[model samples]
Target: MKNVKWFAVDIDGTITLNGNGMVNLNALSKLRYLARLGYQVVFVTGRSSIEALALAIFGGTTQITIGENGGVISTAPNSHKILADIDKCRKGYEILRCELTHVNEKSVFPRMSEVVVDRTFNLDEGNRVFKEKGQDLILVDSNYAYHINETKINKGFGLDSLMKALDIGYDEIVSIGDSTTDIPMFNRTKYSITFESSTKEVRNTATRVVKGENGDGLINAIDWIMEQKSYCEII
Candidate 1:
């Protein structure tokens, strides 16, 4: 759309080829092209802010990144804002560790705001435990891992934070993702895109569903956006 100035994209299943954490060169190149065309591209992902920041630095996108499923927002190499309470996440993790079997932390980059664990336990059951215990924690599956974060925090919250920081409005952005964690982001933006491989919920939440998967899907989305009459006029 003509008002669109920023592209908020999920990194894992959205841009990474096959969701294996491999960078999709073609998709990355498209993002770089968007940057060259004066559109800001921000990486919004479930990975650690540090990891996502690194990708932004090398991927030729904006320097800012939203990571840890809206729990962390990193703007520079050593600068970041923590939006979730790590102490609460740790408490939830302890409770889960004691009540469930095989619930262990996953080995990942150092996280500043949340706890991540393997997808070895029932996510609903884990959240139920939190509810019964009067905890404000929630367990969200990114399809890559399970994250323990504050119930109020989500990608939409992260996007809001970014909007405030950048002095932009939600209507000026388009979100693209392929997972449940991305639903909040989809709801916040006027235009959202997802792949055919995404879950029904994700596909339904998005404004558009592309036929391609992963990196291919991202390329298709960019191409489609570029082909729009308003977008062409703006360019």
Candidate 2:
């Protein structure tokens, strides 16, 4: 309980297992449980900060979020700060839009720190095109979409920033996620949990692999953490 005080959870494939882009009540309840237990649950996700903020407000009193795979940080519902340079993001996106044939305007979300879009073409080809346009930017594919993001930016970077701002430590946070994008956070934390249904890379990266996937998996992880912490305290 003393060492682990925060949960940096992934959104799409981790918490909302259904891929419906909405956190189910079951997931929300466990988040509330964490809050009640004096734990801060900051969502570290591929979803935009606005989307993450909405989920935070709906879930519990946890008002902070790291969204767009560590591109934006939101302490409140309506306000947030982007981590990436706006000029670089703009230039890369503009170049990519001109170069990539499958850049779907309808599927694209506005640039925050990353340009997100649904998978329409070969992601490998897309990444190649993006790199050709802007060598500084990289394309990351998660459970749902493709993201044009800075090379150095990732979930771990976002979580690290959040920890510094809140005066939390790396060992004090439990990073829970189920995507390739979640790998860096896994390395950043001493404690990382993923689900059975995730990719082999993700499963292997995590310290603990839950028997279930998505919300059920997350809830199970939370219970396990509580038991582990309790045992640690007793000892």
Candidate 3:
């Protein structure tokens, strides 16, 4: 691509095909190719490091992962060094409790870390469900699968940390995601994109909206970006 050194992609609906429970081999290979071409690919997802780690292991280390919306990151999940850790996470959860009087203490951090404090619930009955049983946190939605942590650390903060680590300005980044939490990155970047299956809140904020849903849309968008004369110059 052009001089674009870093690529921030939302993992759930964008990279892995939301709800499929499988990573597209073709798409994963393309991502690995992009990394080989010298672009820093970042998987920005609402999933926690644990969930992201599962996908990264399955994808075979093609790109770095930013998990818990943006709260934590690692080159790979099992690795000890965190790319991002909002120490204020616990504090954020404490605040969430004050604002949301009835929310279960176990589910507050992971859910509120990245986005606004909307609501909370018990693990088994949430809109987004965490796959790991026994963990008090679970996403009750179809869009993301993250174990609830003690803070709302999420994609927005995660992107900012990644940008800081790379010493790149916000204007130099390209953020692509498909949910409400992706809004922060969209608002901060020079170019922001959302998949066709993205929530309305995400699509409305994007500078461009790709045609397909899930991983298909992400692959198409990345291909389109690579075709642009300006983007081609990045590599």
Worst lDDT run of 10 residues, candidate 1, spans 226-235
The candidate that wins on lDDT is 1
Off by over 4 Å in 2: 106-110
Error of 2 at 106 (Å): 4.6
lDDT ranking, high to low: 1, 2, 3
- Candidate 3 lDDT by residue in tens digits, 166-228: 687765678887777688767767778887777787788998888887577878877777777
Candidate 1: where are CA atoms >4 Å away? Answer: 229-235
Per-residue accuracy of model 2 over 39-98 as CA lDDT, tens digit each: 888888887877777788877748898988898899975678788875675576677678
Q: Model 2: which ten-residue window has the lowest total lDDT?
A: 102-111
Better of 2 and 3 by lDDT: 2
Evaluation by TM-score, superior candidate among 1 and 2: 1
Those runs of model 3 whose alpha carbons end farther than 4 Å from true positions after fitting are: 57-63, 76-152, 230-235
